[model samples]
Target chain A: MELTIERATKLQTKPNWSDLTFGTTFTDHMFVMDYEVGKGWYDARIMPYQDLPLSPAAVVLHYGQTVFEGLKAYKDDAEEIFLFRPDENMKRMNDSCERLCMPTFDGQFVIEAMKQLIEIEQDWVPEVDGMALYIRPVMYATEAHLGVSPSKQYRFIILLSPVGSYYAEGINPVKIAVESQFVRAVKGGTGAAKTAGNYAAALKAQEVAEKEGYSQVLWLDGREQKYIEEVGAMNVFFKIDGKIVTPELNGSILPGITRKSVLQLLRHWEMDVEERRLSIDELLEAAKNGTLEEAFGTGTAAVISPIGELFYKGEKTVINNNEIGPVAKKIYDTITGIQSGDVEDPFGWRVQVI
Target chain B: MELTIERATKLQTKPNWSDLTFGTTFTDHMFVMDYEVGKGWYDARIMPYQDLPLSPAAVVLHYGQTVFEGLKAYKDDAEEIFLFRPDENMKRMNDSCERLCMPTFDGQFVIEAMKQLIEIEQDWVPEVDGMALYIRPVMYATEAHLGVSPSKQYRFIILLSPVGSYYAEGINPVKIAVESQFVRAVKGGTGAAKTAGNYAAALKAQEVAEKEGYSQVLWLDGREQKYIEEVGAMNVFFKIDGKIVTPELNGSILPGITRKSVLQLLRHWEMDVEERRLSIDELLEAAKNGTLEEAFGTGTAAVISPIGELFYKGEKTVINNNEIGPVAKKIYDTITGIQSGDVEDPFGWRVQVI
Candidate 1:
């Protein structure tokens, strides 16, 4: 795959890394590829990150025909840049593309393009604990058509933002509101895929939770609003009787990469991992009886965010009294170590960028 | 609200209304408004229909923090423009805005701006058999932030597209594929809101149905996947044993205005309109034994589309054999007549623009 590079017209000098916010500051360059019905995906390139002039009738702006994937690049003690299981992200992106009717590109081509862009913005990758470059690959329908059907032309673009630790307090647990009134994903929906609509749909509940002083909203199954699905943007897991329990691979819950990795690590550590239909009643009962040792959410940004308390049905149930559980701490350490290359990666999940 | 009207820099001289697809053709002007956190929504104007220059880091392009409402302006026999329940559409738009964490605007302000735009593009309203000027009111996060939090800045836009008759062949019934694999909206999600994400999530399944030789996919309820929820962009209803049955207003289904109007019309006609949960299995049983009289989808664009056949699990269930049912014909006639000013709108739904 040939690449065409274009440097930004302007670049920041002496960029401040101390107060950098996640997703606010972006790198100077962005990777782009075009897809058309007759020619398929082509014209892959890394160009200067700038404003895109879009027709008023573009499908994405109107119909929300967009999908995106998020992963991060870590700078290790050896001063090397590495991406953790980028191919997995690429594969998941393809899955999302198929669901959104977007043209899929080769995973290797995207990975290579990402590495090139990371190399160009290597200096922007902050060298701080829990700080790394967050890579975002977005595919959108760019065709200037107003039809409700899928677009014939599309654009795949990648951007990078150096994000600090998602939680400012660093692994300190958070209060999550169990929203029985609102469900995030329904069965046979686009909840499993990393589509734009899933996130957009959750913003309202998130806003309500934030107003109530909660970090995120824990969504239940849409039909009955009883089964535990996910927490806003992350997949959820529970620890009952020292057994790792997560919701089954229902079409509604996103099959997160970090979630998969955590399950593998638990299995490798000889801990029993059970993927089943986890219900809210079961979790509440377990927590009340002290059988639930821990509860956490997993995603690319936050490896594991411990759930301190759950507000559900007008009742506040403190799972662990706003403290991070041991299992959560252990998983966080193991995953962060693997990502930073401080520990031996037995599964070979990391791919070196430079 | 002070208005700024800018005529289009260029217009399609030879307008092709004959080959006008659904949303492909646009008028010469559009309505726009801006909203910032501190100042609220302001700067309402009618601007030239042109490209929207968006920053690379706009939040709508990433998080899908957007919502929209659809209505239409119809030209009567006297060449007068009339809007059907535009205030209802405005209220629904703000309801969606609240769900999406977007700033709300006054209904009158939006209506006033829309009236100006309609006056500018009054000629675009087709005078053919079943044609109207489609109005799309959209609100999205325009902040240049990368965080997943609610945006402090937003853009509310109104676009006009002159659409031809939804059914070119005079409203022939359609075939629907029962999608047991994909779900559109979940409880506690943005299912009730007219949000962009919900539509984005349905594109893939809609494509699959088309490939399977169906016009649309019938979405089942998220939890059970047994209950009928909706069809692509439309609320569904079935006539079973002289009763009009539709899914109950759980938090997951959009409160379609057309759906509400139809139910009212049915009730006015002395038909029993029951807004309750209708199971797919029950419908199938009814279809097998001839209890199912007719099935149709209701939305803004396609006022009512009769379902000719239902394909579920590799079985074909014909509904009235491609003939529009008696109840459906009445609904189609009453709604289109009121919209075209051929009948009196007793509910005070019509708002004349010119």
Candidate 2:
């Protein structure tokens, strides 16, 4: 029930943030905890990041009983780091564990531990204009069994990586291909849960879209293949006739944190917004009628990613003449500004760690 | 590539045959190989079975980019081991790789390496009447990056487990519940592939069924939730009006190896069999008309698991007076007989080792 810290013997020299690839570099220390069925979670420790000595038959390797969360820590000009809505991420992680039949941990306890970790690794935070310290929390089954049931043992780990800017270049609109061959998730599947198998099942579709010269794939509903589900790993929004429109939180779609923030901001500003089922046919028709004004994706990694073109079933529809629209740009600037402590924290979403 | 063998300095004590669990007990050695993007698969070796040193950011531990296969090695009275349909398992493993966007390997080469592993762990095979050694072949992404895409590195492993007899208390009919809430898989999803996420997704439903006094949960179609899909990870079969019927391979159903063998055996014996769409309504109607005869599930773990009762929304249907039928008995006996070399294997499915 007590947290312990064991420092590394030696630290490696830090690399230039601009030249580093996204999520490939890490800090010196990581937080780890173990859990058993009757024993609950215990032995919390901050240790040096190194190879994990796992059993050859660990359940996560063969059964995919794993869950993960992604967020970032941004530094203001005065050298203080803030994490946005860390509580929401922890709650969502518990939801994922319940869906996967795993155990749940205390949210406040983990947030406090994360703060301790951030305080120790304060110097690792990037000073670059667009970069941040990426936080990755992962929990997986460590039971060395070949049975296809819920595991009795588990390991929870929180890793820190000094990531490069998601938009190294300017925030340009990207080309997306509407996928009809593969479905990302179904209503009765693990789509709403941030588990590993959903992403693994989507790699083939993404690979095919990449080969066809598309930046990402826009998935439709698995049952009907009509309603829009997600664009790549992020939630999508479309502006039609000066109204912001996004798909509702159905069972098959992930509830993105950025997507929720955008909705809250839109409602606070008294802007027109609609959350309902938006089909691909309806979207394409709106484009033909000149009502489809803007399109973009929202997620933690990029914050806001504009969509310049969409190709589906041998049909092409360009939006806003292949440029970032005013609404999208405004939302991006506001959200990022709030994260870096440059704007008013009306919602009080950001929590200072150091 | 050539396979190098590194024997362990101190061998582990062989576990008691009857006391060992199904898959927790393992032999002394294992086979491993590596794969990278530019370079093909290399560094094949048969080494001691121990802990696997893995990176904290390995793609498989987080993203679930993994595939696997299962089979058993049976020993006859003459001290010779028989591997039934190893080639089929190897080919299916490659199919699983293609579906998950992972790299494929030489099936023949892996099979040969497995034979060598079996030879080295010959003494570990159980001599019990129904006991055998289970072979698990697993492939998973090993790249140490946090990107949600296809990994650049992977590892393939083969492990042998000395398992106890599944029918230690004699084969008994199991009660199954028809699941309407949580569907196992949907069409155009990763249902057909032997991937880990699919199993992880089904655990919640299985756990609920077990608590309600059911041995397994029978899955329905995701789109309509009417037609039958699978029964607790195994393919299902029904006997109505003297005809053997099963759900067709409609992309959402796993192409089970044991299911194929059953169909072949039924056809070889000139029995009536049908592979088509079978809705739950039609099946329930058959049960009401006093024509429903038998039902069973097929898989590598249990060659033929008979179903005695089926539970649906406030309705219960009993089959064959809650007993195994004549046809089900014949199929199980024939399959087990062929596997143990007591009956003629006309299909040449049994490959010899040692």
Candidate 3:
């Protein structure tokens, strides 16, 4: 588990904390490892953030054999950094790697490397209440070939970016367009894996939604385009008649880490929760019947993005009068509180890195 | 569309023609261009073959917003080079770019650039009877951002590889597995585009088929898994009861240039060809009745590959007595003859580069 270290000779000036943006400014260093077919994973090192010299014929650039994971490092008032459910992200990353046919590594070793990386760049963790250092771990096929197969060479990298809140409006409920035109992923596709292709498949629909004045798109099942799958890059949840309901992980929905935590928190509080096939028709009916109490999206970027409006087939459904519902607010507060070390850790989900 | 040229100072030794492989060796130079949101496509140049310096957060690596086109440059006995329907490849590449939200350029300009690139490395074009220089043009998002949206910057690159026949066995019929479990693309998915994600999604199935002693997989439709869509990155055609049949372009199958050329050639030869849905059940039924005369796959890489046998659900269907059928042989010979200047170019599909 020994890691090589290389310090930067010159460091760039950090961005103003008040004006930080997502994924734009990065820390001084990054962690990297490479894997060859016969050599396995080797050359683990934490070096200064630099451009990767890649072949023009690299498989990742041509076939999209890449996977990534996203999580954030939080700093509380005590100035200690914590990672929320990083082990879960590591496990999910391995799952994504397996789906993409890339090599998998020991999650614990990688987590330890991430901890060292975070320790060295501790100052980059923003002090703002809602802001944290965004950590991105990515793996891609590096084989310089044109064949449509798994790569024999691979590279895994971890980069850190100083960030602001995901939503520019700061957790205000967002308008979502229920997309029925473009399908994201099918049942037998790579949807369940956090692979690059699923996100690429989603860009067009997201663009259309944004053009229509919606912040994100609500994706339905690829087969029928009827059942709700996810909202944008997050797992979606709806509160109907005092019960929390989310679409079950049916091999096409990404098993989000935040979604898992929210469900756990709800179950711990003894709330009625159900994970099942939730259809858009049923949701619209509930909205019409005044039983759709709350709706929100959960992800690493935006812990809980309350959905204020849903546009489906030229019809709009306003939920909770365009306000954050009580349930969403509670879930958001409890999760963020635990992440920032302000609230008691009942679930013990937070891992201290620094 | 003026393209600047930069010659390489040192070139690597060319691989022996006898030992040539697919997509591994490279030429002395490559074509490259860049695109910015408002600046449009610019900086077109032919430069020495070298590694591309990419950022860790490049959108293509994380989101898979990449597309590519494959064509080949053939050398005739008279020392002249020809490109088979390269204009079609350019047009399809633009279609792919539009689908991925990347900027599209004039097809003519890109084709001219490709020609110049080919002329610069004309010696790299193999003179072997079955060998040619494989040309690959790729476009990918280069914007270093973490959000799941279209990239504001992109890179378009073209690299050349001198290779032998796609099948090391020299166009011999090979075994294929009918995949019912894993789906490649659906109607609303990115199946029609020569994008990176679609190929990424097909790798697992291809791997499984390879493990089952098959060279490729016959992918069915994503929804029902009933109808045939494609075969191992190629458009498939079947000769059922002496009629040439292929899956229609229903937005879920890549409109292969080789496939189109073959259809036109068949029509010119006064053969009955139909573009319609051909289900596996019907194909198996035809096999049982001894009406399935031939089955072949068409693509840029493998111009025509004969399917010797199909394994589906533990049942094997041997086509044309596990040999290259008459129709497939004629089609392959006609196409290759036209490409290599051994046959009349009545279809005007050949573009003379030098």
Q: Model 2, range A121-142, lDDT digits (tens) per residue?
A: 8888897767899999999999
Candidate 2 residue-wise lDDT, B1-354, digit = tens: 899999989999887787887778888999999999999899999999999899989999888999999999999888899998999898889999999999999999999999999999999887677788899999999999998888999999999998887788887999999999897899889999999999999999999999999989999998889999999989999999999999999998999999999999999999999999999999999999998999999998889999999999979999889888998889999988898888899999899987
- Best model number under TM-score: 2
Which residue pairs come into collision in candidate 3? none
Ten contiguous residues minimizing lDDT sum, candidate 2 chain B: B14-23
Model no. 2, DockQ: 0.86
Q: Of the candidates shown, which would achieve the greatest lDDT relative to the real structure?
A: 2
Q: Once model 2 is optimally superposed onto the true structure by TM-score, how far is the C-alpha of residue B303 displaced, in angstroms? A: 0.2
Candidate 3, residue B72: Cα displacement in angstroms equals: 0.4
Q: Residue B9 of model 1: what lDDT?
A: 75
- List residue ranges in candidate 3 displaced over 4 A: A167-170, B167-170
Estimate the lDDT of model 2. 0.93
lDDT of 1 at B354: 96
Assess each model's interface with DockQ, reporting 2 decimals per model.
0.68, 0.86, 0.86
What tens digits encode model 3's per-residue C-alpha lDDT throughout A167-282? 55656899999998888899889999999899888888888888889999999998899999999999999999999999999988999999999999999999999999999999
